[model samples]
Target: MSVTSRTRFVNPRLGTYFGIFVSSLLGLLMLLLIFEELGTAEPLLRWAMLLGPIILYAAIGLSAPTREPIEFFAAGRRVPAGYTGLGIGVAAMGATGIVAITGVFFLIGYDALCLMIGGLAGFVIMTVMLAPFFRKFGSFTVPSYLGRRFESRPVRLLAAGLMAVPALLMLAAELRVGAAAGGWLTGEGQGVVILLMVATFVVTAVLGGMRSLTWAGSAEAIAAVLALLVPVTIVAVMVTNFPLPQLTNGPLLRALMHSEAAQGLPIIDAPALQFALPGEGMAHIAKRFTAPFGAIGPMAFVVTILTVLTGVAASPWLIPRVTMTPGVYETRKSLGWATVYFGLIMLTCAAVAVYMRDFVMDIVKAGVPSSLPEWMQRLVDLGFVAIDSAAPLNYLSFAFDRDSVLLSLPVAAGLPAVFLYFAAAGIVAAALVGVSATASAIGNVIAEDVVNGFSWEPLPRDGRLHVARIAMAGIAVAGGAVALVAPTDPLRLLLWSLALAGSTFFPVLVLSIWWKRMNDFGAIAGMASGFAVAVLTILAGEANILGIDGALASILGLPAGTLGAVLASIATPQPSRSVLELVREIRIPGGEVIYDREMRLLRLKSRERSS
Candidate 1:
């Protein structure tokens, strides 16, 4: 085969491999379900659930190592659109969707739809505005693209530094979720489980970089989707005698609304734009379930969606995956696949929330918190749920950990603990997939963009791959340290990541493609100012200096970043003719990737120097 043909060859059996991989997982679960019915021991089931997927994914990573930089960095630009979309969708959902957001839905009811709306909309924006252009340029990392577009190493390095902040923050967030799931499975301390989780993430990415992550992530996405839907569907059948939870949950929602009234839950008297206090004590009454802006203010909700929307549009991890496809057309198709998968999983998330609420109401209506169901009481004893033995158990009488509610659903409905383990295993898969993708992006920026940009002599291909793997390990350790020492709420960490990313990259990424006037000065200024403002606002909000929190903190940062860029670009001289030509070239499609042409020139020069 010609060199180009060799580079573009993907294994035809890849689909068969992943199909069997997913089927095997399902089979294992079914066998475990049978064991549970036969009264198998709980610890044995936990070990199987915790270790099985890890062993399988690790084996894939171990076998996927590649010395070729093309394979390591961009999967040789040959992944099918279906797999590419599945990878992106998996990273987008991660544990935040499977664990935290499911709990968000259960806790906040209709208000949680903001997350779903922002995320799905972000995919749309990315599809239309960014992905195709980036794929045309074909740089493996976002910093590489920005640096080359502006023809400035300083711009590239600065983007690399700014990108790492959100990347590591997201890394820590996923690790936190994984640790929580591990703790539940093994009955071990989060510290020990987090260490294991960190090792797993590093191993998955370190072997083959993007090559390993893409395929392993595809498998992980399958496991996560199946894990989420199967149990929820079973619960749907149990509750409504219907197999489709997404469509059949309407009656359950109505019943939940009635339950809110029966429990004397009051509608909020505050304006939709005003923040409300979370009530104190276990038996405190919450706002009515269907009330808009009950969990957060209107301003906060709108800002959160905008930030998350832009963040998803400009997500560094997601952008690189688009470039792994065959071309601009396949890239667009992959995102369409992402939309389908993301929408399905999100609907399942809504179903999980409704089903979980229905279960909680069952306990509340029973009016005896002390006499909780065995499963619910287990969760309570584990500190995942808290209930007060008051005379009349209402919504106020019980409190739930947002991270625990989805996992607790099987047991809440008196199902076997095996189902709980399946849910936890799926959460682990989702978290690992996210961490692997983010870690790969961060390592690529540091190794290929930042470190390599500073080098007087470029490393050979093998040397570059080694450096990237080392960088991946270093980032994993740093992220693991944060996850271990100061693991905060996963949802809060995710918000910081989204806010920082949207503020720092969103405006610059859009302008770089659409506006020819965007120069290196603007890119540098925009990224720096946005990064600073986001960090300050989040810190101030946490310190109570301002009301800004979650995604709301980015409201000022984004506009400030945009204005800073525009003004800086205007004050500086317009970009040179060559730079303007480059921009025009990037805007057009169906040509050689600019990065590939540049690399070929570099290789030719290296050979001339050697001779």
Candidate 2:
């Protein structure tokens, strides 16, 4: 596909332009509000930060006249391989993983880093092994693929519910982060920030639908990369001045030197690096060089594999990318680009954490005000400060305090214009990308999965579009409500979402794709079992259930559910031959027909065969 073809098709309507213009103006106004409230040195810097992404989104909305709004949701089978790949990479490496994961690395040390590397490796494996198959299958949504594969509406509905739950949770977390950032910038309550953020998603989705989201998402992804990179580069330059090499030479040697200097009483022959400062500790050094495992552990490893596989195998978002592109080869090429970009973006997140650790620490030392919002003060008190450590960093701890840390860092840095600009942009990009993707996810489920499940009839294209917009608004409103009542600990909510996905959907998705023996009975049982285990584990406060942490629990939980389902299926009668055939067809390569077309064809052929 040509580059121009991949770009958004414009809507000539003045109202659309007006909507875009209004949104941009509101964003500018919000930025100014935040700057004034925060008493930051670079208040005007907020305008560029807010205006850039808003303008970009508006431009996308303006393109709606030429392009169908559904394209924003699914890219209408027209996206080029390169753009699709980039979009996928950006979409996956969203605020949840990039910002949240970095905070985890900073807190835990090298162990967390190791875990992250393990997770990435799992993604790589999925890319080579599972992504190809998913690309070949060419279904828009996972549930659509499931419905086709099983020839059971119940299965599709069930899968949709599963997918929707996690997606919503993720959306909420994204909003929480965005609102917190806005509050910090504006010194307004988090409530106001949340309302604005949620409103953005509603208006954009309502106006341009998927077409707008896709173009906006792509543009936001680019902005995100720059936003994350600028501040990281700045901090990296600053940290290079520290005596890093000397700190990591040898713990024993350092201890002896310290003892000789008689600065303080040495506690241990070689103190664990976790006890020292960012640049001075062995733990900090380990974190920079190693990967650590905290909550994700082996379970995380399995979940990561599952997430990537399912993402490729059955995700609606990816399906549209395949169809939108002109051809299969182009789609594959796009996937390749996406993989590289995803890896690069994830790595950049780690680098940013390393550079920002000291900056965070400085903020904590500055002391939080009692009058500040509870979330902000908690972040400071909880030591949201990242410490340079040799051990894999614990991102979870920092994640727990992310809202506060992100808000105060600029101020701690004396509100440098450049840093604030980058931070603000990153916050907005992360929120917009996250909310938009979520809105798309919810819309896909409702339009293609839930609506079709009731009867094998596809909703009219326009009706489907209408339902999607409604779903988007509903989701945003729900997320805003959750943010209103959510815990101050941002990381806790994030971990809960990850853990839920890892334990429930992660296991079921992996087994369903890889194991042919996984019947519907097995799938149902497995999903239920995995979800139960995850919820129970969280309630019980057990970090490692059955000696599995991180992504491993999901891997383990899959077996538990799969075994139950397998046993049940074995005891029951087998599904009909038609059902089996449907499964095979759904899994086959180049099954490019839309849900409605495919269903009609299947019924017609079935009647003919019977006759």
Q: Which candidate is the best by lDDT?
A: 1
TM-score of each: 0.95, 0.72
- When summed lDDT is taken over every stretch of 10 residues in candidate 2, the lowest stretch is 273-282
lDDT of 1: 0.82
- Tens digits of lDDT, candidate 1, 242-298: 999989999988888998888887776444444332321122335666788877778
Report the C-alpha lDDT of model 2 over 58-117, residue by residue, as the tens digit.
566556532343364555555656666666666553565666556555544333443345
- Which ten residues in a row are the worst by lDDT in model 1? 276-285
lDDT of each: 0.82, 0.55
